[model samples]
Target chain A: MADTEKKKVIKPIKNFSMEEYISSGHRACQGCAEVLAVRHVLKAIGPDMIMAMATGCMEIISSPYPLTSWNIPWIHVAFENAAAVASGVESGLKALRRKGRIPNKDVTIVAMGGDGGTTDIGFQALSGMIERGHKVIYVCVDNEAYMNTGIQRSSSTPIGATTTTSPTGKLEPEGKSTWKKDMVAIAAAHGIPYTATACPTFFTDLQKKIQKAKEVNGPSYIHILSVCPTGWRVPPNKAIEYGQLAVDTGVFPLYEVENGAWKLNRKPKELKPVSDYFKGQGRYRHLDERFTQQIQDKVTERWNKLVELCSEKPEK
Target chain B: MTKPMEQISWQEIEAGGVITEPGNASCYHTGTWRSQKPKYDENACIRCWRCYVMCPDAVISPDLEKNIFVWNYDYCKGCGICAYECPAKAIVMEED
Candidate 1:
């Protein structure tokens, strides 16, 4: 008789509290993936944390005057200074701890912002924060465009997508002409201890990455591909599906660069066509077949480069 | 639209970075925003709890006594994510 094969069982996290840190009554959109990402990230970090939120959709929705949804201590700073503020907080707390001003110094420091703030306006501050080796986690909730500012194109916006600023017309048929900025590569180039990409669709993967970022001793960068139903021109219900498709189609692959070592988190069994991800979005609805093919070629090239990076040995 | 500093009285001017009463957002009911509602079928539910886990609103809660999941509609914005992600097809979105 053949030996009985033992199946491996994957159990969920034990004693995971479903407590809500970001409570209801806040004015986020019905299908706002950015706020959802914040909720999940806060849950992973728990109560003993302070957030330095940049001026963006997350800040605007949560911190309207006299009303707030955040259960943790949160500070709202300028659009381009969340990282700078977080660095100050980290240093200030360290100083206070040394002077016996605070009893404990175990609290985590987090800085959050939208794609525009992260990849564009806040780039300099973020670079300084990482280079200074502050114990902080900088989370870029990349919804691909400036969703808070009425859907303007940002550096992170992908090519061939239509935004208010990058409108598709007779003159500019391809919409946004520039490719999406490689933010993960930028963070990795900073030589941070941990840098990762996550999406809300993969909850466990996202949570694990957040937890890992929290555990890192130095600066960590987490780029989350938050889905924007309103900006992306997809139905509210399709947010998760679109997020999943982004991963499956290699438009946004989930990976991490830890201590200069690259690792691919989720390799799709069979890569889906880029059209499968783009067809649902209204932003990409204006794309012709030729433009879509061009976008597909770009995605394939980027994915190939990523795969090569993952397979290569890290330098000493 | 900018108001002159001299024209604005101290009493009328709003203070910045101060929340006297924190976490009072719960006092406000946002259920009026919901256009559709989630209907759960207890019989069809296989206790997978995918809807409970994936709800972005955190409105779904497991009823240990009843051995089922319940939706707190007071804050649910009717995103349909719960129904869309239900593995057992136990949750359905219906017009409210």
Candidate 2:
């Protein structure tokens, strides 16, 4: 134990906690973006939190029998009610804390659900939570379908996309014909303190947005584009790739709305073609040359609007 | 181009932060457990630990004698209550 004998510098890295909250065993389909995003969000939120999960892929996979992948306090009440359960948890805790019967403000209640839960069935409850100004965070892990319910179509399911309910065939050129509902804008219009969209593949950006949401006083909503390899009919390893494609192809814009201002995160220095993003997946298989071009045009229009919004922000 | 999951360093999936001579970073891999990192602004911190106490993982530590709350992220779930609860806007979240 002598000095100067080449003290191997174990280069100091970013110090994170040693405690493992989301324990190892869970059966999320490989390349499941929801799982990846949830893990990052939990890590960012820290352990002193209770989460209300909706009836989705997350709940079924994490909680089966006595075996639970979640190391922290987590709950799965029902489908389309993740926000409701979270709102109940926040208000219930407030009452208990005020009575000095339980831990005072020691817990942060959060709701995590899929696009189907937050945008369709649970939309009313979600709106109520935001409008009421509950001190909670709601994260919509939008895989774009009801994965737990066997890949059914949800309101947020993109146009010309395929789902179990909307499978393409000779009769149908594409699957779903409806456009994706704008849930983030819906959240923003509720006048919540914070609203933003994140992709699971970009963990750093997702983490930063979560931090921003935490600082808001009333309620915060994070709409995450969590890719679904099983639903998307792509290879297990391609989950994050889909997320990247979504942002790069302008299908999903990476932006944050703070105090009614939009801030775009990444701008493609050399934008990739939308078809490069679409052709990789099986869902878009039935779309003909004509339809694909139309879809691309729509995406471009939306992206331009986003850029305008970003530019509208009045300086620092 | 496709290698076994075991062969690939989980760190490549995510290294919280790293130092490498060859421009390689230590991935704070989410391959194993979900991670959360805390950022602090000491200048604005009143040392009031709404975050330290609210952290479900209890990863943050403060020398009560000194009143400075430091984040220990290994156990942190990245829930962001510390950043949210902090009245002074002190605690921030760093992606791992």
Candidate 3:
């Protein structure tokens, strides 16, 4: 029975590689969730893949003209074309393999962009690529703002947070008044092969979604709520902690939409108050008691909605 | 016969998907390109193995012909550790 349990534990992080593709010496801010997501994805995807980066924080730092910190074959494309570029690379690789030019071995094409690219500018290309049904994985490093461009609010920005454009003051309860855009449901609506939401604090879950996206034959999307320490006005080291708090508070539920089924990976055994998730960040520091409860109510409602979707009686 | 675990597959815990088998997918040219390369000094003649040691992917080589470290720029991330660690001020970081 003990051996059986050991085998069970091995399944989740099964394909996690020991290799490092996102190499050290990157210029991302201390405790940037985007960097953590990239690090984990690289370890999961391994060396058999080629990546295309967008004109976000990753592209600007990893490859600025001649300089690059990428250990794998990478192409730095325009701001909004990471997904489209990846789709092109996927088709090119398929053609090259058919003609015996490139190796026919499984070559995963992953495109990574920030929330600005993903939810705002790159959404059409991203949706088009997914609808086109190419074998690729597009990850949106949803920091909720354009961190590389001084933290401007994007559609992915949460309802109660401050950004450069959405500073907390007398008029605004929290910086951002709009509810966060649901990128996962949007991607799921595309009817793609797989869509998952992950947080960098949970390395095991992050890697699995990456592996699933790579294993599947068609387009896969993962919207990772990568925390931005600088943008969120938190200390550098608390990035991972904030990620855990987001999930624990049900502000960001950990779940996956695989094949056609939605599965909640981690249910909060005891839900933490949404205030803890809010209090640490300067963005939501302006929220009063009533606004805090309002945010909590919204989170609870969203969490219940997720539970309902994941509650499909598991096909008898 | 043993059956797969019944609890929602921990595979879902990570989205654990398997592709290249362990050990087989190990880097092919690892510790190879760095096997030997030429190291040039704009200043001194000290030869330390910092470049030889700090390579995480381990793809550096000592060029026996040029008697210095020649970088395998194809695989290098331009980390510049070698340039910083060169005791002799020998290794220079150049754009490729």
Number of the top-ranking candidate, with TM-score as the measure: 1
lDDT of 3 by residue, A147-252 (tens): 8888898898988788889887788756789999999999998888899999877878888889889889899999998887778888654676788899999999
Docking class of 2: incorrect
The model with the greater TM-score, 1 or 3, is 1
Candidate that scores best on DockQ: 1
Tell me chain A's TM-score in each of the predictions: 0.95, 0.92, 0.93
Error of 2 at A89 (Å): 1.2
The digit string of per-residue lDDT tens for model 1 on A174-247 reads 99999899999999998899999999888788889999999999999999999999899888877889999999
Regions of candidate 1 where Cα sits further than 4 Å from its true position: A1-15, B1-15
lDDT of 3: 0.73
Put down candidate 3 lDDT per residue, B1-96, tens digits, no spaces: 112124334444323222222222222222232322334662354334445443433335555454455566544444344555456677665544
**Complex DockQ per candidate:** 0.30, 0.02, 0.02
Could you estimate the TM-score for every candidate? 0.93, 0.73, 0.73
How do the residues B3-96 of candidate 2 rate in per-residue lDDT, one tens digit apiece? 3234556555434222112101111222335444557886577654445433433456665444456655433445455675577887766676
TM-score (C-alpha, index-matched) for candidate 2: 0.73
> Candidate 2's residue-wise lDDT over A120-199, tens digit each?
88889888888888888999999888888778999999999988899887777678987899988888888777899998
lDDT, ranked from best to worst: 1, 3, 2
Candidate 2 lDDT score relative to the true structure = 0.73
True contacts kept of each: 0.41, 0.00, 0.00
Give interface RMSD for all predictions. Answer: 5.3, 15.8, 16.3
